[model samples]
Target: MITYDPHKWLDHFFDIRGSLVKEISGRVLICVFWSAGVVYFDKNYHDVNISSLLHTLVGLALSMLLVFRTNASYDRYWEGRKLWGGIVNETRNLVRQATVHLSGERDLVVHLAQLNVDFAAACMYHLRGAKIAGMLESQHPPLTIATQMTFALQEARRRGAITDIILASMDQNVQLLIDYLGGCERIRKTPLPFAYVVHLRRALVVYCFSLPFALVDTYGWATVLDTLVISYVFFGIEEIGVEIEGPFGLDENDLPLEDICTTIRHNLFALVELEHSEPDKMPEGL
Candidate 1:
């Protein structure tokens, strides 16, 4: 994942609002062309009417609403990103602490490392809308979700070959995992208010539909081009906001959680191995 400092440049490039000017400019050109057509058909239509006023007002309102939507969506998107950043830090901290405190202790170190991997995978699955298999039990169970989950994790700690200090670190790691999970749940459960979404969508549709009528009298044939460009710009931004709000999944643009998890695994393993083994060159695969 992106481990670099969260820069506004990233926001400027990725943020939806940044393209509004371009969208508006292109549509204005089309509107002008269409207005010329209408003038050619009937010069009297060149005079602005109430419909023209309404069109201007609607365009202005749509622009403002698009800005507001982008702001709100980015807020949610950034918050989710920040939360994941915390998870990465905490995960690394847990492993580092375990390695330091449990020096010369291999058994517990292995167990803790495995737990770290499992936790990251589980969280990924949960966020991607997958049912956390092995998390629930009501079907029929000698060991229910409650008994199995708590017991398995605790038993891993109790029986693992780590030193006392390492065990303590593992406990802290578990708590951190719980907190991260709760944060993820909060993002998942709480969405943009339904009323707000409904209002914004209705406004967008009305704006797009009314645009043609308002511009047609003045721009004629150019109205079609103007309408398509303006409509796409507004819709494009709304689509991005919708995508970012979830911030999880295998979408090409979604946060790269899998890559982050793999990097953590590689780093932790490399650190542990370096501490014990001498560096050696390896031959190409057999």
Candidate 2:
């Protein structure tokens, strides 16, 4: 995941530079060839009739639309990135509060803190469409409800004091966990609208196909190179937009949620002054 900061664009672009260049180059070549062929055919058969004025207008519109498309897609990508940034901060905040509030209640405190870490990892895997087996190792649905209630009962018994104030504090912290889970679900379930994706895709394809028609009349065989060059830029932007729309996935350019989850785990563990231990080996069929 690109860190959520303004100064690191170079690092982010460098990370995905090769893939970007490759996609753009392919599109440029395609446009160039199509443009050149159309020009050649027009000259040979006297069939081309596109006016210079009309060509210029079409080119202008195409350029504007491409720019707009690039901006819109980037906006969506950045929004998703920002949402993940919120998740990271919220996770840290939750741990900090839990540690401070639950002090002196060693077992209850440690377990709750650990669960926060686990939940963070679970959310990350779920968002990326990765298998959930690892995150769900200790508990399963239906059973988890009962198990969670039982765990709460234990924590209630283990509270620092039996006063109402302590109970209220515990309740508040527990509710924070619920809120975090809800936030993750919101991001994972809600995607950019289908119509927007469809429209963008259609626009890109139309521009690609029309490039040959637009350039063929003037450049003839030379239009091939021109089309290819322009197509490279346009296609590269379109492809990047597609990759970024759902930024949670495992793609190279997608947010690195796993790394973020790892950070949460380390932070929570450190706060409790717990000696770090390697996670237990997962079971054979787990």
Candidate 3:
């Protein structure tokens, strides 16, 4: 989503706009102040005696858990991408097949092609949690439209407009479209489980808050700086996982759902446009 020129290391470091800075800065500040308190408490009333070994063990355990959390989140993201990728490829195949087999039924083919495009947009809108008018399929507008398109194909087949082999091919693509919709819905509906999220958050918060106490005796006042950096890393990783888990929302890391549908719409129409735009090449004899 965020395109960049190849490997400008300095620019990446200084960049603030798209950085996780906004998300992590507040927590980083809290860590700094919390660390400062730990230092003051140690300087005034002796040290808290929190063991370095104890903190190291807890941090190690939490880090492993975070790794699992982030990995699961990224798995969902990639799954959503693959499902939508299937939508893109299968839609094009469907349109191309229609153009080949239903060439004589120009109007019908164009209408069906447009429906396919509509199905794509509706599918994305469904994923993004947007409400559709008339409440078709109760916010599952994509599925509703998909069914309509399939029925239309059935009618065409019954009318003897398309051959049996061609109908079978088109039906396969339609089934794929339905499967994609189901896959996206599965991701959207089932997020990281509640108990898992709760435990992870609680452990991370406890670990990060206790870190300064553990380090203050060793590093003294420098604990503030260290705490900020460490907090940024821990919180940033989790925040990134949260943002990308859905892969359908407005987050920059989320898939570009609208753009994908827009390109497909353009392509489907363009495929049809090519036929009308230029006259067929005259035969050599003609």
Candidate 4:
């Protein structure tokens, strides 16, 4: 996602990158020009004035629909973020547990760490409907890595490297990872209702196009400015919803999956190194 200081008011107005202005600019311009034509025609040739009261009623309904659409999309986005946060925490907890329980078996600890990283990376790719370069062609890469993690824990238990209790604890973390993965998949695969989206967009178009007729009588030439501003607000809100609906994509507003995966890898490797060097030197808030 595009990072910025929200307090910087001037920068936001000047910044065009990753803004919804680009997406709605064309529509706003069309609305402005259409309003101008309507006003000119009404003044010179024929009157096309309509009741502004009708627009008032339609605008209220349109605002409610836009609010609902935006809220639903943001709910999916926030849920996805929360699920990934769970994954991050669980991965750390699992690795920290393994570091303590299997301290003597450095290779096994490293392997477990790498597996966790792989699982996260696989999950990122899987949600995006893509494949990592080295990952084997599998129906579900995250599940494959999850299975490997389970086997590793099982083998540790079988060989008496870790007790049954330790194995169970680590296995629980693995299950949580799968659960988070499922949550993410649900968000990515299940979109908003088709009829709802269709009706919302249709309402927006009808309202914005018909707004010029309502404003031309009172605002005259200024109807163009009013229509442009109103269209921009409505279109921008809808576009923002679409941008964040699927939070796994590469859009500037989408979740930073790539950076998140990289962070998990780095933290795991750092934890491994810390354990190897000084077991007592664990970080404060890992």
Candidate 5:
């Protein structure tokens, strides 16, 4: 996500890197030009009249559409954040359980805890749609980690390192990981409906372009700046919705999955007091 001082409002506004303004600049230019045309036309024949009465009704409808669109997209973004939060919590619980129950078998506990880190990272990679690469060359990294964790648990049970009660408690957290994975997948696979998106975008474009015509008659040449700002708001809101709706990808606005995954790894290693390579140097999927 884009990061800077929130208090530095001007700096934030003017910052070009990773700003949605860059993506919508071309559309803004169109609005400016369209408004200029409205000015020229009004100066000459004055036949073009995109009436204010019509705009009042259309504007209300368009505002509602953009509001709902942004709200729905933000809901998905928040939900995705909560799901990853769940993953972080459950992973910690599972590893802590292993460390506590397998007190005597530090090696086994260490192994399983390390695997939990792997599992968390794998899940992040899975959600972000990154193909497994390097040491994690598998179709399903999370599933692979799940399998290893399961095998280790079974071995611990067989060796009497953990009782049925402890195993069951640990299994609950493992189940939670599975649930988190499925929950994230559901969000990832399902998107805002295509029809809604198409209709809203088409409507927004037409409205922003036509706005200049509707307002210039009343506002005079000043309508250029007015239309430009209004179009920016409309387009920016819709574009923001599109950016966060998925909540997973390489986009600047996407979840910081890499950092989150690395944190899981570093925390797991610290919990076990097991030496690990520096997070920066660690291989991918670690």
Candidate 6:
């Protein structure tokens, strides 16, 4: 996602990198030209007056629908972030426990830590509908990594490296990884209802096109400016909702999954290095 200082109002006002201006500029221009045409016809040809009161009622309803649409999309975006946050926390917990509890077995601890990093990377790729380089043969890379981790934990428990209780606790963390994966998949697969989106878009177009009729009577030639500003607002709102609804792609406004995965990898490797370098500080048992 694009990051900026929220306190910098002047910088943001002039910034267009992550803004919807490019996406909605064409629609806004169409509305402006349409308004200019309506003004020209009214001035030179005949009186073309539309009921301003009727347009006012329609505008109120459209505004409410737009608000709902934006809210729903934001909810999905926030939920995706929360689910990834859970993944980050659980991965750290599992690695920390492994580092302390299996400090003597440095090789085993390193293997487990690598698996956690792989699982996180796999999840990032899976959500974006892509595949990791070596794991392209695997249908579900995250699940495959999760299964490997489970088996490794089981082997550790069988060989007396860890007790049944410790194994169970670590296993729970692995299960939570799968749960987070499921949540991400659900959000990616399910979208807003088709009919609702279609109707909302249609209403936006109709409202924007009819706005000229409502404003030309009073604003005259300046109706072009008014329509341009109003249409830009409406179209910009809708474009933002569309861009953030999935929250997994590489859009400027989408979640930064690459950065998040890199963080997980760095954290896990750091924990492993700490365990190896300071084995004397680690406790004997869990």
Clashes of each: 4, 9, 0, 0, 0, 0
Q: CA shift at 85, candidate 5, in angstroms?
A: 0.7
lDDT of 3 by residue, 99-158 (tens): 777777788679878988989988877888787666654646787777777876777788
List TM-score per model, in order: 0.71, 0.72, 0.92, 0.96, 0.90, 0.95
After superposition, the stretches of candidate 2 with alpha carbons farther than 4 Å from their true spots are 2-18, 23-28, 58-68, 134-184, 274-286
Report the Cα lDDT for residue 137, model 1.
Answer: 39
Error of 3 at 135 (Å): 5.4
- Name the runs in model 1 displaced over 4 angstroms: 1-50, 132-170, 278-286
lDDT of 6 by residue, 60-160 (tens): 99889999999999999999999999999989999899898887778778888899989988898899998689988899999999999998888788778
Model 6 compared with the native: what TM-score? 0.95
- Residue 69 of model 3: what lDDT? 87
As a TM-score, model 4 comes out at 0.96
Off by over 4 Å in 6: 279-286
Question: Model 5, which residues run further than 4 Å from truth?
Answer: 134-137, 274-286
Worst 10 residues of 3 by lDDT: 277-286
Checking candidate 2 for backbone clashes, the offending pairs are 1-256, 28-228, 28-232, 31-227, 31-228, 32-224, 32-227, 32-228, 36-224
Q: Pick the winner on TM-score between candidates 2 and 4.
A: 4
Top model number, lDDT: 4
Query: What would you estimate as the lDDT of candidate 4?
Result: 0.91
What local lDDT score does residue 154 receive in model 2, on the 0 to 100 scale? 50
Give Cα-based local distance difference scores for all models: 0.63, 0.61, 0.84, 0.91, 0.85, 0.90
